[model samples]
Target: MSQRIFHHPVLGSMEERTALQFQFNGAVYTAYEGETIAGALLAAGVRTLRVHEETGAPRGIYCNIGHCYECRVHVDGIPTVRACMTLVTEGMCVTAGSVLPTPLKKGGHAK
Candidate 1:
């Protein structure tokens, strides 16, 4: 899918801005500074962020707001972060929920 909204039928031309790079599932993608992580992923054509832990069903962003928890992802080793609420940062590392490793406790012990 196209990563840009050049001419919105309603909003017309979007303001131009510098782009940033972030890693999703170890692959780098370009993102705008103010866009949320879910928006960035959607712009890059990433439809699935994770699979169900038990059922293995695929999941993506839903409800765009923070309530649904359906867009949970790991950001820079921190798991369960809602992508729809988290803005993308340059060099940020994002992982799909299904492949996220078990989080560790302080002092290096696995939680």
Candidate 2:
């Protein structure tokens, strides 16, 4: 789905935002200045964020309120950041796993 909010019955038309750039999985993408990392990724059509540390199952945003740790990702070399809670900034590096070596590839790549 397109990330642009276009129009909403309750929220109405989307407001203009200052566009910013960030890197996800080594690729640069556009994002709004105030949007969350998860929101930007989701808007960019990224459904999965990372693999389970124990089971290796694909994981994405679950609670979206920061209570659940399911949306954890590496941000600027910091591992296990809650993507849903953290806001996006220009040039932020978002990766899909912890700092330690894992079976699955980093940045949403499959094992």
Candidate 3:
């Protein structure tokens, strides 16, 4: 999806300027302070958030209430982090890219 997902500002007034900035898909975006990167995206109405590390399957923020594992993403340089549970930091660069290569599934091969 395009960066047009957010224009109206869901967290607060843009003029007030707690506007946190970051780059996603090469486009610069302004989110908010104290909100999780995932929360900021969701508030901006971002749909497709990331791809699976092992399968490259398209993934997004599921279980908005934060019980499901679908929202896992990489923050800074950390891996296997639950984006929904973390707080957004100013100047933080979060990339929903991939986790490390997982071990083989069953039968000595990937699932």
The TM-score that candidate 2 achieves is 0.82
Task: Compose the digit string of candidate 3's lDDT tens values, residues 2-99.
Answer: 24233466765444437777755455566776667677777667766678777788898888667987877667778667778877776666677754
Give the per-residue lDDT digits (tens) of candidate 1, residues 1-111. Answer: 557676899988868867999999999999988989999899889989888865568999889999999999999999999999999998999998774344664468744
In the predicted model 3, the residue pairs found to clash are none
Sorting all predicted structures by TM-score, with the top scorer first, yields: 1, 2, 3
Best by lDDT: 1
TM for every model, in the order presented, reads: 0.83, 0.82, 0.65
The C-alpha local distance difference test score for the whole of candidate 2 amounts to 0.86
Arranged by lDDT with the best first, the candidates are 1, 2, 3
Every model: Cα RMSD to truth: 6.8, 6.9, 4.8
Residue 89, candidate 3: C-alpha displacement in angstroms: 1.2
lDDT of 2 by residue, 1-111 (tens): 456676899999768888989998898888887899998898989988988775678899899999989999999999889999999998899999733456665467674
lDDT of every predicted structure (CA atoms):
0.87, 0.86, 0.68
**Backbone clashes per model, in order?**
0, 0, 0
Candidate 2: where is the Cα deviation over 4 Å? 98-111
**lDDT for position 89 in model 3:** 74
Deviation (Å) of 94 in candidate 1: 0.2
Candidate 1 Cα lDDT to native = 0.87
